[model samples]
Target: MNKFELVFIPGPGIGHLASTVELANVLVSRDDRLSVTVLAIKLPNDIKTTTERIQSLSASFEGKSIRFIVLPELPFPNQSSEPPPLMLQAFLESHKPHVREIVTNLIHDSNRLVGFVIDMFCTSMINVANEFKVPCYLFYTSNAGFLDFSFHLQELYNQNNSTAEQLQNSNVELALPSFINPIPNKAIPPFLFDKDMAAWFHDNTKRFRSEVKGILINTFVEMEPQIVKWMSNGSSKIPKVYTVGPILQLKSIGVTQSNNALNGADILKWLDDQPPASVVFLCFGSKGSFDEDQVLEIARALERSEVRFLWSLRQPPPKGKFEEPSNYANINDVLPEGFLNRTADIGRVIGWAPQIEILSHPATGGFISHCGWNSTLESVWHGVPMATWPLYAEQQFNAFEMVVELGLAVELTLDYVKDFHIGRSRIVSAEEIESGIRKLMGDSGNEIRKKIKVKGEESRKSMMEGGSSFNSLRHFIDDALTNLQEGNY
Candidate 1:
């Protein structure tokens, strides 16, 4: 039996890199004959911190069947001037030659290269996998619902021969089976509306559904059985898709920054003093932020709801500018007048909170979240129900799935973004935010909590030996081995 190395090409972000590395860890731990090398592309703004975090994760996985090769930072002269999605695309495009070199050397050294696993953003790397006659698998860092929608949206456009302008202009709700509710026209991500971006997404979805060997989603069968079932059985377009996830190896990998001022001990201690399931943990994802007015509205909402809360806030980026983690600032300057003083007993506002550790706290009964896929999984893993407030990306779809399909969350308007370019979303008024807060943390939230608790138990059980997620991993390994032995990859 020969050992195999799977080359993983992760997009430039902590979220993408962490999930991919964790997946690699699980794959190697499950099969002793497997190893992985992550080709990490460094983004211009995140080079320093991303490097440090990856170095830390690499150290923790030391002596294990995992290693990392950080590709040099791409020389993007206009990095400071471009948006993140565009910047990330440019970085990945520039690093192709480097990735090709690494993959070629591994093969030349006679390493049994079983497959090439790529993050969703790095779908273009399928070409590299094809060039070397290796199978390519997409490691989706989000839920199966998002993946299903992306595939369906692509097919919808392809079948209709609809232009992006027509799709954007139409008021038609997408009738996707993955969602119990139809996706509102406005709730659709901007990428699907822009001609060039839609083309890029369609191209990738085409490759993923037809050309890619498999898709590894970061969700469990129990958490999203409907969508998972649809992808595995109902959809003929989607290739073999596996739910080998709730792949949270961040703790084992120790991926957090050690220098954060938000002391985990103090936060946990406060939670310890609170009644069980009494506190609502509020956090947007890493890049999530609100403007000054929005921050004021949030403060007012929290104050009105009178719920015990813990908020980890990042300063809003400048108009039309992107801000990195290193740029996080205190919230006192932007919060409403005397807001901190009034809510002192009810809430703790910090620059950054250790999210995983916080969510695991006993006092955290409800979560007010941006509905980022990572945050959604983390909250579910801890049995915390959510008040879904999505900011951007596929988060709106994730929110819809949680509230409608999965019956796990309360919604804060899915049409929150009225305009993407001008950042002119309908401001979630303080009253509406307060209502959502009350609904999630109050007795009305009991059903949602009950549902999430059951799913959380299922998540834990699925990760155990012979469990759904564990078996899914084993099945994927078996397929890879068969492909290798048959000389089909």
Candidate 2:
């Protein structure tokens, strides 16, 4: 009869926030005694869309026990000398006091504060949870494989006392428990090559092992059975992990509010006209975009492949500016001349994709993605096979997992690093893109296509009652209640 409350602190990105909200929704829906209050953080680059998305989510949960509280946005710090990752870390750290204030007021209201479900990047909030004498659970917005890799990397770093330069320079293949084969040096994320970012992740992984009660990963057991088993049974240092996913936002969560609704409608209508399993959908993650040269290569490949396609081509934010990539005012300006007219019969290029809707369509057969964890899960859930083109972050590692470990996707390239710090590591040529498209859409992709279809059904089954993810969610809830009853918090 006692009611319990969980506070969810999501990271700044839309992907992180969306998955966290979905998890919160699931928790509250599973038990009426449970309630969730999401402490939303505004994206640093774009506040308007962030606020609008939060508002939309709040509207969707109207009258539910889930509540959203947008945190006060802080001004960008004057740490120009620091790397962007470190700067973002500091920005999140600055919210500690604000979090403490909100939690204090919640307790004063007689709410039974059970735990703080913080995003992976917001591990610093664990300190705030400790101060309030509540258990902290990390909502890992990524897959278990990535989490396992992080722990392994941290172990290696501590054991060797190695520098970023040393690790990058060495041509060593890491035999990690997460992957079936040894991960080559190039496949490792480029961020690990930077001293500051590597150190930041090292510290974060330590906190994950030593501080949190459990990590609730946005992945299912069937997706990464070996790595999930390794985290739960093989390693003592790893915290208790609950695989309760694929946690996805099936609804359009207001990100597309900025885009024209008619455009979204027309895109879907176009998809309806295509033959079943014919169109290969290409959308990088929200921040995923390319320069003129890369765009031209993709345009050329789409034209050559002659595959029905929907390409979400975004214009990268201006250098040194902290903003989301905007839609091209005239996409033709950056694309090859007459490319649109030439491919008018075979493809359609747009911006700001309605990904879930598109993938759910019968016409969508393949995905060319940036391998962001959310996008990966969505693709799997919808039974659309992917051709991996990882742009940054842990995406390269994710690409490796899909292509090498799970055999669920075709590989375009894994080690493509396109960010302000390093720029494009290498442009994927039109020939390579065309080949990948052929493999994804042609007969070459039949095996992977069949595999993803089965996995998609399994993904859905996992979320149903008595299924793996459902049972995992129940276990997580029971553990939280047990902690409360034992006064462990």
Candidate 3:
């Protein structure tokens, strides 16, 4: 019999691509009869970097049953002005014909195309899956709480007939389900302020969940049980939910320099010099960069905090462009005078530090992160606490849950609009940054460390045989098999 082949469509970024590949790896590893074909989507402005990262991930899976096929980059119509949600929607919508063709050919060849596992951004593939008469599953790359929040917002909007402007501007303290405390408007995603994009996303999520077979979240039940419970309560249109993750195990590259642009030895050597759990690794996600003023303040904060640090800093994005510049300028140009030299003994600054490798190192203790879901999970997996600095997307919600609900991180700032690039004169002051770092690195962080340490153990256990996440995946596979035998596909 032919192996069960599943098609996975990932959104356009390293985080989405990496997590999707990891999930695929888990699927095939769990069952020899399973195989996955990842359909990579190219992002608009950052095509080169994105493709390079995807290629690296594919190479890492060399002997594995997973394969990658990249889709063409979406053509930008008025690319200068379009937001991410709209750009993503356009890309997925425009590529529907291509996806349909691919699926049709696979069916014609009699491949055991059991299901379509698609990224949340690529929900447009649901129609193509329906057309091909296969089950479609949504793979959410973030925490379950973020997923619940999106649906809750949608439900609230629907029930209240609230305008996007009113909802965005309202100082409503919501006691939303799936969370322990009330959620403030400032902790919501900044895109909600954009009336059109917010409406589009809300409607798309509602349709996507209602239309798909189920959702596979990249989270374990132990990490966010409340949120997972809320998601699986069957109140939403999504029929089933699976928590089969903390699934970010990158195959060993075997003693070479890490794939990030920086040298692995240099990063490791610096960490080696520090005491265990003493150094803080700072990195925003792929798209994270700071303005000159914010950069200087970070330098000042690092200097004042007197904590050992490694910063993976980036230049701010070019105007009307979302990608990093091909070349980097000197840090001296942006940092305060004598800041780097004075902190040289305690801090190491580099561009694009190998985040996962560094996080796994014993010398690394805390993370000052953008709270991107991928980073958050990595931090937890390594048993490291975080100083949360959410930049964009659902990161603010992730930070809120980490700090307020899960008790895993310290907050630098939770204001959603403050860190955004659009005409914001306020910079998070050096004093406040220094204070947050001190709190994270000091004895006060002991409880958070203990909590995350237990979580790390639970994360590992969840993937073991008979564990919650392990059983969840097994159940999903069995259900798919039953449906196949019943001719449901």
Candidate 4:
């Protein structure tokens, strides 16, 4: 193939888009033969109605050698106090016609339809790929633990007694690997264990397994052999499974600078002031939020920890605000009283910080994260340790994997039930916060630093020319093209 073309799909979050964009850049740079297009597909809708539309940043991806396509125009998923998962299914049903039309066009125009390295959440595409007789590759952006956790969601739900209440009542420690302690189920994202979400996600995952070409994850096989083997060996006709990642491959291709105006957020300016390896960078992945109480609890924790920090606290507006759904909305100002003033000298708070740069700064030593996979990978990529406090989805599992399996994180848990839904207040007391912060800041800090330092080097090496990710990208194209030549498409 003289020029290879592939389409990438990402959910409506920044991390997924950032990584997908990185993948496209790397693929093109690695081969004169490759050109990749990105088709944006929102899980429910892209933004919470309260925040400013993300259009400015989204528009910047209109770059040379890359084409941007929005998942066909579809009605925004109906919003309610309902969990986001339910809204997603409703959104898909409403957009089915538009989705079908786009798929038809894509399949018709493409030459030998190579393969789709899709956000595994876009399950609807499996049908279209199969209809076109092209291979569909499940591109799992999260870690192997999440894939393993999500894979069991359907089975747990099918047990007849595993209701949301049951998952809530049970402990994750017992449900998951033996090494970690239990966390509340509600802290997990609304995506897992909810029957509707499980049905949609798992069915598509299962279909993709049965009918698509193979599984390609953004994690290396050595890092997750048990799950990888179970995946490749489980299916009767499993497509080949390839693991190569910590996918920051674009950095190797010199795709570091963003010329977009939004880069003016100037996060690096703030980082320059902090002492080397002294600031704990705190930010949950975009799309994550905390309840009022959790917000105050974090404020108290940070204040008590007395660790210099840079924090980004951006949460979706409470469900009721979506009723009016306008651009300028009452979103920020969620932090607690005297919180900003008390910590002003010790920490910097922003709506959103340029994360990669902030995490990479020499002044940044550790992270207090929600354990979102991309954040986990990015922190590891930059050689930073974490204070793992997961709040949702399979993140709880990733936290476990990091602390128990990888030894790269210090798991901080507040193992108690919260009275309210968004969980701002239900956290460790001020004392625990102080201790947790200290553990990651001093001599213990250097020890954790050494462990993660090697990981960053390994992560970078894995995507370089002779690396696993580099070679895997090559194999991906050749396999798809050769299969197409044999009349697969």
Model 3 pairs whose backbones collide = none
Estimate, for each residue in 1-489, the C-alpha lDDT of model 1 and write its tens digit. 557989999887778888888899888888899989899888676677788888888888899878899887777646465455666576677888888888888887545898999999997788888989999988989988888888887877788765477667647677776666777766677656766667767777787887789888899999888778888884456789889989885472343432225466777778888988988888887777777688788889999889999987776655654544332455567778888899888788876677887788888888998888988888888899999888878777778788877788987666565223436566789999999988998888999999899988998999999889999988899998899899886
Off by over 4 Å in 4: 42-64, 93-96, 103-112, 152-197, 225-238, 249-266, 320-339, 414-425
- Full ranking by lDDT: 2, 3, 1, 4
Model 4 lDDT per residue over 416-480, tens place: 32212333435556666667778877677677789888877877887778876667777876787
Q: Per-prediction count of colliding residue pairs?
A: 0, 0, 0, 8
Report residue 6 deviation for candidate 1 (angstroms). 0.6
Write the residue-wise lDDT of candidate 2 on 1-489 in tens digits: 547999999999889889999999999899999989899888566788888888899999998889988889897665455767787788899999988999888887656999999998898899899998999999998889888888888887888765577668648788885568888776788889888789888989989998999989999999998888888884547878999999999988664532323377788898889999999999998899898889989988999888999999899898776567888777768888898789988888888888999999999989999999999999999999999999888898899999998999998887788865666898899999999999999899999999999999999999999899999999999999999999877
- The alpha-carbon lDDT assigned to residue 52 of candidate 1 equals 87
Per-residue lDDT for 208 in model 3? 58
For residues 225-302, could you state the per-residue lDDT of candidate 3 as single tens digits?
887887788765556989999888544332333223447777888788899999988898777878888888888889
Can you give the lDDT of residue 115 in candidate 4?
68
Name model 3 segments beyond 4 Å from true: 161-163, 235-237, 251-262, 324-327, 416-425
Predicted structure with the largest lDDT when compared to the true one: 2
Greater-lDDT candidate between 2 and 3: 2
Q: Against the hidden reference, what TM-scores do the models get?
A: 0.94, 0.97, 0.94, 0.81
